[model samples]
Target chain A: MARSSNGESVFSRVVRILEAFGPERPVLGVAELSRRTGLSLATTSRLVSELVEHGWLERGPDRRLTVGMRLWEVASRASPALGLREAAMPVLEDVHAVVGHHTQLSVLEGREVLFVERLSAPGAVINVTRVAGRLPVNASSSGLVLLAHAPAAVQEEVLAGPLESYTPHTPTGPGKLRALLAEVRRTGVAVCPGFIDERATGVAVPIRLDGRVVAAVSVIVPNDGGAHAQIPLLQAAARGIARAMRPGQE
Target chain B: MARSSNGESVFSRVVRILEAFGPERPVLGVAELSRRTGLSLATTSRLVSELVEHGWLERGPDRRLTVGMRLWEVASRASPALGLREAAMPVLEDVHAVVGHHTQLSVLEGREVLFVERLSAPGAVINVTRVAGRLPVNASSSGLVLLAHAPAAVQEEVLAGPLESYTPHTPTGPGKLRALLAEVRRTGVAVCPGFIDERATGVAVPIRLDGRVVAAVSVIVPNDGGAHAQIPLLQAAARGIARAMRPGQE
Candidate 1:
């Protein structure tokens, strides 16, 4: 492996370059890439050239760099998340058909919930969560379900403090969050009205594999009084996803 | 970028490591990684450690290496394919619901067709295509549709030679393939019966944006002489996907 004069490895620099692109900024100029990655113009240019040569980054007709399709293929084909998403898709489609809103599958990633799949309709309720997006563990229903089933160490760390509130109804206090988590575990579901958006209610349930919670399946629907009515459907869908994800099951 | 002793950059080696994992083999031991990547054990070990540290690769409980969630997130969130998949998903769902078979969205990558999204029912006909999977340009309906609209240079290259046949009915001869491509262009659809599998028929239509073919939306159903009936539905769905993908639409 090669290292720069600043002691950063080439792999590290490449990671920074790749991370610079996101849902909000899918393409960037070389100068913007250099600024975003905090690398010198020459180094950024050289790295970008190498990346483009390997098809990990693409230079469009306008010469702006975007994450390449080859990179997406390589990352996605063998991703551990792919298996989970595959298992959840059918169930999610069913749920989305019934709910006619936003149905999502998410997993615990570090201290946040990373959404791996989401199905939305044309006139679906407002949903801030997009595929591959993340939200604080204490700010969404899926997060609460995952957090409730998370390891003790993870729960303690999240409960330590700094729980950012997205809406006035979001549970930010450690004591209230702890109670909410307990309720989630006891009830086997998390239903939060106005957790992230005032007009939406999030309902989620744990998806277990081999008796260990691996992910959460949730739906974002209008914050009407009918939110709880979808709980059974979500739980059933979660169970179906778990069954489909089990080993040796096609 | 740093170069190894043999002048190979770290980025190139990392690409090899990532590419070594695929749908058939998603997990590998360190020794297997060294063997698959053709990198020395010491180099592979050090690189794997660095990759694990950055969460590009994860070490499972059994010490096997798999592509990490962070890598998938970074590669997916800004992927150019993500926008296409998002636009095609709802239409694909509709097609899948009506067809009750395998509905897919694919794009041309070099001389191959890469499936980016697919929806399948449990009892559907046998279809080999998977999400993020690839097939030769002349071996599938989607490939033929994309190849029909591909640049003339690419078409000539593919028609030049080495057209691998998946089944006896697959178009292998240059003259036949050229005629088929012409038919696809003229009809605005490709119907391949027994192309990839004897029991399945593939029907595809081009999805265009800015008056240029961008992708192929297809469905695989039983090869029961009813494949052509799906042409209109697929064309409508393709048009809907293109409209959804247009800039500033939603």
Candidate 2:
């Protein structure tokens, strides 16, 4: 959520302050946050002071500010990502060890694939996925598997809009994308070569919880060799994750 | 922040609504939520309606509301737990593969040991520790290591408090705990036995970043062994995590 330059509400301002901290800019000073948020310096100072007092933000020894442990603790105790991510990590780890590549778990959020966990090798094939990061629902194999199982309206929304092409192989046409999704649902796996990068391919299978496709488990491997063989491994991992989500079933 | 009994802010109400959803109960009806939150049915309905509109909560096909991916994405993206966790996974995986027990990462937060990550084997020793969970600063080995290195004020506050004992061996007297902390600092390893549970011992070592102890790496093993033997392994793993955390180290 965003607000106008000069008339933003306090809640929107707090959201903006948190949003200003990203992967590349994890820590910043109040002045930098003020500049980035387009808020007055005095307002920025007041807001940062309030947030810090509430334990939502913490100032480092260098006078730079970052997200607070309290906020992380609260958020971690929040059930959406933490519970599913916790259940998936061990299975994701198993897949990573077995596949000797990058293993990731993601869910469909709006029109993007929001990564929950990713485990990678030191010199694994370069993967663009990052934990808590997003990829277009039509660009990555995990996204496609999720987009395939998504409701028709969500699919229509994604297919009707801007489809970003991270690499030349990323399917941009809505018609081709629709066909790809249909194939994904039919086959129960999405395999893509050079969809996000030329040298990497993504293979994914949907993870179901309570008979719904709640998440997707995927692996990133070199574009060469039998990438197709990775499908069963991913499916097994997905089954394990689904079972973990449903404890009694496990 | 908790508001006085009545008239809570919408954000606070939304947070309370979220807190109602836990790992045990991931989904509930709107009425069930209201009953759990003590909010009027109308107020709960309206707030939950807004949450659904904002994608912070989603309704499943069964008409049950569950923690939505949007909330997860926002909280996860803003979390301090993510960066260090990403760097530690490979190293923790290595240790997990060899040790076949729980491997945990913790940081001192407000005189408590806040666990950022914990990887456990399916049939590993039962532990009370949860990822993003807190342990008393004097009860667990990780907490002991963190408390030993905490600022003097934090140390004093904990020592001045009424310590709660989980088991017979849990040190409750401030004087004894203070001595134990000193011993932990001297040995570079915190050995806690029968504190959390009588069947287990926690072995922890501080992980240094830029020569300051930033976190603690720990493992839980059966209490029967000489815990001193596990120190080298935990210390080496902590060093590995520290090396991974260094700037431009990866």
Candidate 3:
């Protein structure tokens, strides 16, 4: 019931301010935050000061501000994704060690795939996915696997395409994508050669918990014939994670 | 500033509500939340509803409330500790593989040690650390390493001790802890045997960024002679993480 002058709740304005920060831009000035949130200067200043006082945001010696460690602690300790990420980590490490490339775990959130965790070595192939980054639900192999298992309405919405293309190999046509989704559901895996980037290949498999598709586990390697060898590895890892999540099953 | 009837800012009250959730207690009913936050029932109900609407909190099917995935995503994407954790993860994985136990990275926050990341194999030691969990400044090896290098004021405050001991090996006396602090600073590592739990030993070394001690890398193994051999491995991993943090360093 507490509304700001613009008829929005205080909680809504606070979220807008927090959303202005990202992996690419971790620190910002008060004026920039105000401009991004479309909030008045006085309101933004007061909010930022209070946030800093409670360790939800931190101030630098240069007077710029960044999200605080306490906020991360509070969010991470109780995140719904924490159990999945923890269960998948050792298996992901095994896959990374044997396969020697980029490995990741993601879940379908809204209309995009939100990456929950990723592992890569110093000399691995290029990967654009950060831990909390998001990509279009039809652009990456992990996204495709998730989209294949999405609810009927979500599937139909994507099928009514304005599908964005990332590279030459990306499937932009709704018909082709629909056929690909059917194949993924049939085969229980997704493989895309140079879909997101021309120089790499992506392979992913569904991770099921309680007989429901919950996540996608994937790896990125060079766009060579070697990708086929990794599908079995990915499938095994997904099964292992699912078993870890549901310990009493099987 | 929007102040509640109690003269505290609403932002502060919101943070208090969030801080009520922890690793041990992730979900709670609204009445419990009201009691934990010491806010009136009406205020807590209004705030919780607004937070749930904004996806910062979730109302479970059973009507309990938990932290939401959107909050985790927003906090994780911009956390200051993300860079350090990412840099240390590979090294931590290597250490865990070699040590066959629990490996972790922690930083000094306020007067306590806050673990940012942890890796544990199934049926490892009986360690008590978790990612995003905090421990007293004098209670664990990681905490000791961080406390040894902490600011003078913090060191003095902790040394003026009401130190709570978890086991007989925990150094509760100020004089002995002062000597241990000097030893850690001299040798650049802390080896605490049975300090936290009786069955495990903790070993830690400092991680430096830009020539300043910024974090601690640690491992927990059975409280036996085998843990001594792991010292070199832990020291090497700490050095590797420090180098990764400063890319141009040797």
Over B1-250, each residue of candidate 3 has an lDDT whose tens digit, in order, gives 6677778876677787888887678898899999999998999999998889877889998999998888889999998878788888889988988888999999999889999999998889998888888888798999999999998999999989689899998998999999999999999889888998989999999987777889999999899866778888888898899988875664
List the lowest-lDDT window of 10 residues for candidate 2 chain A: A1-10
lDDT of 2 by residue, A1-250 (tens): 1233555445556667877887778889999999998878887887787778757788988978998876666555655788898888888888999999999999888789999888989999999989889999888999999999999999999999999998889999999999999999899999999999999999999998878999999999999957999988888889889989886777
**Model 2, span B1-250: residue lDDT tens:** 2233564544556657877876568789999999999888987887787678766688988888987776666666756677788778888899888888888999998878889999998888869999878889889999999989988999999999978899999998999999999999899999987789998899999998887888999998778866677788888899989888887975
Clashing pairs in 3: none
Which candidate, 2 or 3, would have the higher DockQ against the true structure?
A: 3
Tell me the deviation in Å of residue B48 in model 3.
Answer: 2.2
Residue pairs with colliding backbones in model 2 are none
TM-score of each: 0.99, 0.91, 0.95
How much of the real interface does each model capture, measured as fnat? 0.83, 0.50, 0.72
Best by TM-score: 1
What ordering of candidates by TM-score runs from best to worst? 1, 3, 2
Q: Is candidate 2 or candidate 3 better by lDDT?
A: 3
Candidate 1 residues lying further than 4 Å off, grouped into runs, are none
Query: Which docking category, incorrect, acceptable, medium or high, applies to candidate 2?
Result: acceptable
The prediction achieving the highest lDDT against the true structure is 1
DockQ score for model 2? 0.45
